[model samples]
Target: MKKIYYSLLLTLCVGVSGFSYALQDAKNIMESVKYRDQGVDRYSDVDLIQTMSDGFVRSRSLKMYEKEFGEERKGLLYFTEPSNTAGTGLLMYSYAEVDNKEDDQWLYLPALRKVKRIATNSKEGPFLGTDFSFADIERMRIADYVYTLKEEKENISIIEAKTENGLENPRTGYSQRIVHVDTDKNIIIKDEIFRQGRLIKVFEVVQLEKVNGFWTVVEAKMDNLVEGGSTRLIRKNTQYNQKLKDGLFNQRTLRKGLD
Candidate 1:
């Protein structure tokens, strides 16, 4: 009985140590991906194409701008195509620290002629009929999730993450996510979103290239596994470290089309 008790205690100690190491390593890998310097500011024109499983395609033109202030990142996106959506805009501010504070988001609807604050609970809703959700566009805070290293490959590392208690977004459609990161570039190459242990969506970086000293995804796709639809975003005319005007990210500017 004494020998059996000692063996069990030793096994438990090893298991606890292994779990702690895995958690720390996962956190380090996630931080590298989050804090990898892109630039002080950026601007880009992009095409958003939504395709149905039936082969129908719809496209929209968009202009995006992003800037960093201290540990906070702000971004703005405006739609310029499909007369119906022209002048629609979205503004976001994400913080580096993942406290109880929620990111701020706003949407300008051309038809409504008003800029509306997007509720934090609505983060999981589809963005303008696209497969991508508002949460996907906003920067994810590392503290909001607990991560575990799933697999390590020659060039990619797979990490499994789930929302941490007290940091869970009630409206988030994903209960967990599996991410494949480029070990060299610290960029996410793919993500599989799951709800209740079932895969519901897949996001993939179709193409990437080094632009202005940063590895940029030139083309990406988000597919809704259960909905039978997908959205592809193709970047064009991308400029990094540009001197973006501060006012461009304000609700006032969002309501008014770019001059």
Candidate 2:
């Protein structure tokens, strides 16, 4: 009887220890994804296609430049297509999860001849009528959530992250998210965002490839489950370690247009 009792206790301890390890491992995995290497800088031409539920489609084209400075990242998108949105651009500054700093975003509209800053409270809205939100482009902060390993496949790990900050409305606007990570590459292959216990948005990778030795998402899509629309981003001519000038990432470039 004593031997059986000791064995049961030992099993219980192992189970608890395993669960703790899983939680810690999930956190480490997410951190790695957030800080993946993509060289010092990257440049790409992107096509944004939006498909409405009624079957109508709209498209735009932009030149994207992103660079890393220390632990922070900065990006600039200069719209060059459709003539209407030509010369329009967005400048973003992103920080690491440990800092928990709110990202800065500025949108330049040539028609208005003005540069508008995205308020911290207004990061939940869509990005220029596309399915991807401004916060989505800025990326989510990992410090505000707790991650749990839900499942592990051959090369994928499903992690469920719950917000513990307890804000009624967080910057990202989603309360919880299920991230499907490619364990081998430490890349987020898909993201399922939830709000109020319902799935409202999904981001999926349509194409994944190694460009110039960097794991890149050649194409991706964001689907709005509630509104019945989706947006796809296709990257063309992606080049890494471009030695892009710092001047290209500033508000002046956004105003004057990318050279």
lDDT of 2 by residue, 63-152 (tens): 999999888889999899999888889999987656767789999999899999999878889998899998888855778688999999
Assess every candidate by TM-score: 0.92, 0.94
lDDT by residue (154-233, candidate 1, tens digit) is 98989989987524446566778899999899999999998777889999999999999899999999998988989999
- Please, what is the whole-model Cα lDDT of each candidate in the order they appear? 0.89, 0.89
What RMSD value applies to candidate 2?
A: 1.7
Candidate 2: regions farther than 4 A off = 1-9, 165-169
